[model samples]
Target: MPKGSGKVLAQNKKAGFDYFIEETIEAGLVLNGTEIKSIRQGKVQLKDSFILIRNGEAWISNMHINTYEQGNIFNHDPLRVRKLLLHKKQINQLRVDVKRDGYTIVPLKMYIKDGYAKLLIGLGKGKKNYDKRADLKKKEANREMARAVKAKNQF
Candidate 1:
């Protein structure tokens, strides 16, 4: 109903911090009417959300799209395993990579795309402890450099 106003309901910032993302794919969600309404109300959580290829199909688990407060007995489960719309070839490739390479599928973000709720899923590998520390240090250094440049330019 809104023009050029695609709303991003939620995001999984921890996914990027913990995983080395390899590839990302946009997949549509299978949601009910009430679920979509709740998402539009911005009541969703992406923490601990993950993807898995099961029985030749992809499903998202641990995502909590809160039920509409006004909805009654027909309300969907908050943590239901929602189906992800992906191609058969993509599913096969994800299955192979996850099973053999010790990789994982993590939800990067959830956004309203073209008036439909979509998920940006990433193929990721767990980062080591040192890797996390190094990344933190790099970010701090970049921030310090930017601050110094700003201070110098202010004069």
Candidate 2:
């Protein structure tokens, strides 16, 4: 397999805009059979998901995984809190980082790796409104510069 290649199920694009990501850690999800099926169908949402470390384990809350269409009454809850498997030392470090003001754990991406569901969680600091605006302005400036270069090259 190519390096870093996986079937991505969902990504939280807003996570970057809303927070300054410091570090990312890969964790495994505790998913039911139906949940995995739905994920394979690309029916997962990570926009509102956040990770919390409690009692030495990591838990992800507010992530939505739509029920599998062909699933019967055995379907798992779509909005259930899911456990994330991480090393004890990693969880302890994340807990300490999160204790700092303005810092939180955010779910950045979900994908299937080596036939197993995996989540990429980020340790981030929340961005203020002004920070968001500044980022947008910088993005716009870069876009304009790229456009100018393209036009000049065509001449």
Candidate 3:
């Protein structure tokens, strides 16, 4: 999901509907041992998560990575602010771009690639109320058109 080909652990479906995504970047997560294990087990949620660039560093906040069931005292926190690995230049660029009005960083999905946990983040502009309605209407029209085409082809 969200352009990732690997095993997708979690995804934020609302992110796409709420914002106009300008660009997406895949960044590494600084995860705990148990956290990665849980992620590999597909025990993660990105619905309420977001990305923020602060003090020249990127952080993913409110991302929930459930604890490994077999782990004991060394279990990682389910809701923790994890650091995102990005180049300094990319961070600077994000810092500059995020200052624009209506622009914010949102996490699209989380997946594992090459045995590492990767988070896909997007630079997005918040959509207006009217924009959301128009999008929904367009989607419905497209669906109707597809259905009509299918019926015609079947005749």
Candidate 4:
């Protein structure tokens, strides 16, 4: 139902590679007219973007939404601290979790749902080098097994 409500624009693939995602949260973003237009045009970047909770409020930084082509002087900054809309209870929960060491909030995806911009953020812990290697080895082994089964079935 959530997927049906919105069209995804961009995703941060690097987030998964660099961190072990522990939990996911859906939050709304506050955007201006031109900023929304720009996002709808697929002119957005999530690389190196992250979320922070400060003073009982949540903010997303380093996320770039390109200026709308048609808007002059009124277009929003490409990278700004955009406020994330979430219930007080949700915010409080996230605030508590984020205070834990080695945990962070990473932007996972940007999408338009019900005519509004939404941010998918994840609570993640940085993965060690060996952990990444182990994941890669597992994926490779799975791929190899799949290929062997497919080849045998085709014979």
Candidate 5:
């Protein structure tokens, strides 16, 4: 019902750590026959994948969808560049953002929603090393606090 809320198949955990996600948009994938089958089987990987805007169209490169076992001869390429179905206005907006604002388009997650494959893409800016270190420190502090709370509850 909400953005990124679906039967998640794969996620790029590194994206969040490496980039500051400013906005997210759900886009449909133009998959081949066996590609959808493989995705529905949860045999997909979003890691190392990124969204590229070329010729006023959006494409996702390096997204891996494993070949379907049953689709021997009809199997699709595992790492093909798949087209993303976005509206013309959305594509223009993303292109402008990437070209002008120095933002990178990263694929956040892949999921199946209502029998269709969807990709959650975000407009992100790369984080510096200091920012990453700060985030790690904050995460560690949160973990320690949670542990203390749990230990206190056990008493």
Candidate 6:
């Protein structure tokens, strides 16, 4: 399957509006017991999460996985930093892009595939104000055209 093709759990919708995504990579998450339980329940949030490369390893921060209700004492922290499983070659490529080309690694989507939790991360460059405006305008035009075509076909 392609990247981002799975049972989606959460998504960072604002990432598209704020950055221009260049490439996407699928990665596995290192989650604890209760954390995976909560994720399976669809109680996860990736709104403000971001990826950071440190000590040649990739880690995700600010991702929220609500504590499992059934677990009283064995629950994991809701906002703990989770490590990302990636190849050394992939980590080095991402680090180079971030340091040399001003690219940022942003979490795009989280999902479950083959009974494992997967995260889709993107290499993106920050978009300017004018770019955002232009994108909005283009989106509006497309919506209008679609509406017109639909109405015509209904006659």
Candidate 4 residue lDDT tens string, 1-155: 65324788989998998899988888999898899999999999999898988888999999999999999988898898899998998889988888899888998998888788888888999998999899899989999999999999999
Per-residue CA lDDT of model 3 for 1-155, tens digit only, reads 44576888888999989999999888998888899899999999998888888887899889988899999999998998999999999898888888999999999988888889998899999999999999999999999999999999999
- Each candidate: how many clashes? 0, 0, 0, 0, 0, 0
Candidate lDDT scores, in order, read 0.88, 0.92, 0.90, 0.89, 0.93, 0.95
Cα lDDT of model 6 by residue, 24-82, tens digit: 99999999999999999999999999999999999999999999999989789999999
Question: Each model's TM-score, in the order given?
Answer: 0.91, 0.93, 0.92, 0.90, 0.97, 0.97
Q: Which of 4 and 6 is ahead in lDDT?
A: 6
Model 3 lDDT-worst window of ten: 1-10
Q: Which ranking of candidates, highest lDDT first? A: 6, 5, 2, 3, 4, 1
Provide the clash count, candidate 5: 0
Q: Looking at candidate 6, what is the lDDT of residue 61?
A: 98
Tell how far residue 113 is off in model 1, in angstroms.
1.0
Candidate 4: lDDT over CA atoms? 0.89
Candidate 3 C-alpha error for residue 94, in Å:
0.5
Cand. 5 Cα-lDDT: 0.93
Give the higher-TM-score candidate: 1 or 5. 5
Answer with 2 or 3, whichever has the higher lDDT: 2
Considering summed lDDT, which 10 consecutive residues are worst modelled in model 5?
A: 94-103
Q: How would you encode candidate 1's per-residue C-alpha lDDT over 42-111 as one tens digit per residue? A: 9999998888787899999999999999999899999999999989988898898898565999998888
Q: Name the lDDT value of residue 135 in candidate 4.
A: 87
Write candidate 5's Cα lDDT for 15-92 as tens digits: 999999999999999989999988988999888998899898999999989999999787898999999999999999
Regions more than 4 Å wrong, model 4: 3-5, 149-155
